[model samples]
Target: MAKRDIPEINAGSMADIAFLLLIFFLVTTTMDKDQAYIRNIPKKVEIKTEIIEVEQRNVLAIKANNQNQLMVRGEIIADPDKISEKIIEFYNTNRNVNDLTNDFPTYTHPTKNEIEANLKAAEKELESFEEQDAGDALIDYAYSKIDEWDKMKRSLKLFGGNDFPLINSQANIRIEVQTRTQYSLFAKIQTEIEEAIFELRDTEAKRIFGESYGVIKTRYISDEEPIDKGKLDLLDVLYPARIIEVTPKN
Candidate 1:
């Protein structure tokens, strides 16, 4: 008995079919842009070496433990959804800038040029004090002037203008995460914070620009789009979103 030979099928069209399938996938599939949080970074060459202290009242400290449990300024927060509300409240709190006992400088909506002028005058005064004979009173005066100049400089950068509410101009946030904390929890918390900020900004945008922040930002980026500058400045002053992230610890 002899084994029958198998028939060989034609293979020329198979390669062409695969090529067409590859082309179809390449042309039809859509790619999504990578999502990210936009942040402002300083461009100065000399890094700040001083360990400046921040007031306890101005800092909204949020901590995430290894178990992903959250504590806001020593109080446990049960619901993750409520984090945004807490953040909004913390960011919107008003400080008493007019009190003589208070240390931090107040933002009174002065122009950038005015701030620059003040900084220059302060530098001159500090130099004059240094040139004078040394005394305890003179030293205290010089130190006070230094604080004033530093506060003015910081305000020039942070507030930029006076259109913002006093609450927005003065508040700051500090987040501290433990080393073993889950990335998902941290990401969610960060998202909530950003949502809270957006909610506030969007509300202001709607009130002043007659559009939501999302729409305003989109239109502002479009070609030949003319944005309302005053409204934009108002938004900046109203929602500064000052966040300070601390190093992860045990």
Candidate 2:
């Protein structure tokens, strides 16, 4: 008997089917983005300047030990979720009135006149540096000062108040973790700090602009509108997040 011949399988359409599936997935599938904290790196210093001491009142230190214990401002924190509240307190304690006996950071209300005077001084300094052919670093420093004053002026105008309330320049939120501390705890610390700052900014944004901070931030990210930028700048001046994350010590 002759052996039966098998029919050939059709593969001409296999490539088309595979292509369709690929296209479907490419159009419908979603990707997860990596979570991160954005921070600005300090510029390299070219000139030596006198060291200024930061008062203990201005320091809000959060420490994590190898045992995963948390301490904020020298007080042991049993709940990690409460970190944000502590941060809020740190910022709001002396915001309206300063108490000399308290250990919280104090606020400075610079008047319009003071800001204008500083702006003039900064511009004059910048011009003097240009005339003397100062080094690039010095010139840049002068320009930065001028820009800083200019920002303050804008911030004050946007504030629509008699004075621009600013926290101490030396005030900061410091995070210190031990080498054996878990990464999860470190991230939690950062999140809590972020939450606190967001709350402060959001409240201020609503009070001043009749919009939420998140809304302004999202709009700015999408369109880069100058109005939103100015609003953000004003909020930043009011509630600056001066965070310092220290490297884990071995």
Candidate 3:
């Protein structure tokens, strides 16, 4: 009997408000993460690379002339097949110590056999987990190495340690021209080199049962003229793409 002062309920308005909020959120939310890929633009000045520390032969530099024929260092690679062989040999020798992590803490020094045993155990565990493909593992491992290399570069730049665009996979390789006198020639060589690397990465990931990883184009810092090659030493190698003029070292 006391329902005389009851206020009118706004059910329709409440529903409309809820619907509008939902639409607002749906419009604003980002479903997929966006990542920025940096591209270094070349410059027109005397580039001072100052790269004294030589990278371990992990990166196979394939030099090409106007033609895309691959050259290992300076020598013309007679057999293209041998390039992979050389890289594999380098990886076998230059890979980080097997002891990057001490999997077996109990043993101070595990012999080769003992290491094999550990690997077997890992395989057994993987099987039990029904992990049919170990592709993600390879991708993760490759990314970490690449990240480390990026960190190293930032340190050497005398800047606060920052992760720059770096490809660290032993899989990382290089393609260059002997001289920057001809821009068109080097551009062609760069394209061919990228395609070759893309195919190789595809094949290896398929073979190793690892997730596919693509080698992205490295960024260049500035734009430089082909003929303006000013004292371009091996320091240019540190920069994966485009010639850059760093301020003269103090």
Work out the TM-score per prediction. Answer: 0.61, 0.86, 0.29
lDDT of 3 by residue, 115-162 (tens): 345455554555544455546554454555444343333333422233
Predicted structure with the largest lDDT when compared to the true one: 2
C-alpha RMSD in Å of predicted model 1 compared with the true structure? 11.6
Best by the TM-score measure: 2
* Pairwise TM-score winner, candidates 1 and 2: 2
Q: Rate the local accuracy (lDDT) of all candidates.
A: 0.67, 0.92, 0.42
Where is model 1 more than 4 Å wrong at Cα?
1-32, 40-48, 95-170, 224-233
Q: How accurate is candidate 3 locally (lDDT)?
A: 0.42
Going through the candidates in the order shown, the clash numbers are 1, 0, 13
